[model samples]
Target: MSLELNINAAIKTAMLAKAEADLRALRAIKAAILHAKTAEGFSGELSEADETKLLQKLAKQRKDSLDIFRQQNREDLAAKEEEELVVIEKYLPKMMDEAELKAAIEAIIAQTGASSPADMGKVMGVATKQLAGKADGKAISGLVKELLAK
Candidate 1:
């Protein structure tokens, strides 16, 4: 099923289950999908890759918000944000662990023949495309820098 359809069904389920946080997060996803669909020059439907990217962006926002709330010592708000993040993350692909991410980056660097820090851009270009939705960009960049420096 399309991500939008899945999200709508999940929203209904969350509402029936009286899952407040899940419902909120699902509605937020639906809202973002609709907004993207209606944005200037948007075509009929979003490709699967686009949908995944959008969901990841939403998940990132929730995580960032949760971090801020935690830093402020707002346990209640942080808890709510974390709950929403959990709900949103259910739709994302399983993320790569640090070791897996490092391995993937190393492979990409080998494939691209990246020899030094000067080749960081070439390594990053391929790595990001290959790892999108699987690994976080910041972590991948850090790994690339460390590997290249060595």
Candidate 2:
């Protein structure tokens, strides 16, 4: 089944199970999908890459909110954001571990022949397109810097 279908099914399941938190997160996802479809300049069809990007964006938003809530000592809100984050993560690709990330970055660096920090932009351009959902931007940037500095 497609990602959109899976999300809709999950929403129905959540509703039937009366899972409040799950339902809330699922609805949020569905809303995001619909919004994406209707956004100006969008082609009204989301590719796998687009879906992954959307899910990642949603997860990031929740994580940011989670951090803010924690800093404010708002356990109640933090708990809710955490719950949403868990649900949002279900649709995202598994993140690369440090070792896997290192290997991939090494390969990208080798392929790009990027040497020194001056070539960081060249390396990042390729890495961002290739890595996408597999890794976070910050982690990728740090690893690229570490590898290129070598």
Candidate 3:
């Protein structure tokens, strides 16, 4: 089923269950999807990859907010961000753990013959495309730098 349909069904279920947190997050996803569909230059449809990217962006935003809230000792706000992040992550692909991410970047570095930090751009270009949706860009970049510096 399309993500929109799944989200709508979840919204209905959340409403039935009186799940305020879930309903809020699901509605936010739906609104973002709708906005993307209507945005100029859009073809009124998003590919699966595009949808995954969108969800990842949302999850990243939630993580950033969660971090800031925690820094401020705002437990109540942090909890809300955590709840929303959980809901958003349900739609994202399973992320690669650190070890797996490092291994993958190592292989990409080998494949691209990236021997020094100067080759980071080459490694990043290939790693980002190969690891899209599987790992965070920041993690990949950090790993690439660490590996290349060795």
Best by lDDT: 3
Tens digits of per-residue lDDT for model 1, 1-150: 999999999998988999899999999999999999999999899999889899899988988988899899999999988888898889988999999998999999899999999999999999999999898888899999999999
- Which stretches of model 2 miss by more than 4 angstroms? none
Per-residue C-alpha lDDT of model 2 across residues 1-150, encoded as one tens digit per residue? 678899999999999999999999999999999999999987857999999999999998999999999999999999999999999999898999999999998998889888798999999999999999999999999999988888
Q: TM-score for all predictions?
A: 0.94, 0.93, 0.96
What's the true lDDT of residue 78 in model 1?
Answer: 94
lDDT for predicted candidate 2 compared with the true structure:
0.92
Quote the lDDT for 96 in model 2: 93
Higher-TM-score candidate among 2 and 3? Answer: 3
How well is each residue in 1-150 modelled by candidate 3, as lDDT tens digits?
Answer: 889999999999999999999998999999999989998888867889989988998899999999999999999999999999999999998999998998899899889988999999999999999999999998998899899999
For candidate 3, give the lDDT of residue 63.
94
Query: Higher lDDT: candidate 2 or 3?
Result: 3
Q: In model 3, what is the error at residue 121, expressed in angstroms?
A: 1.1
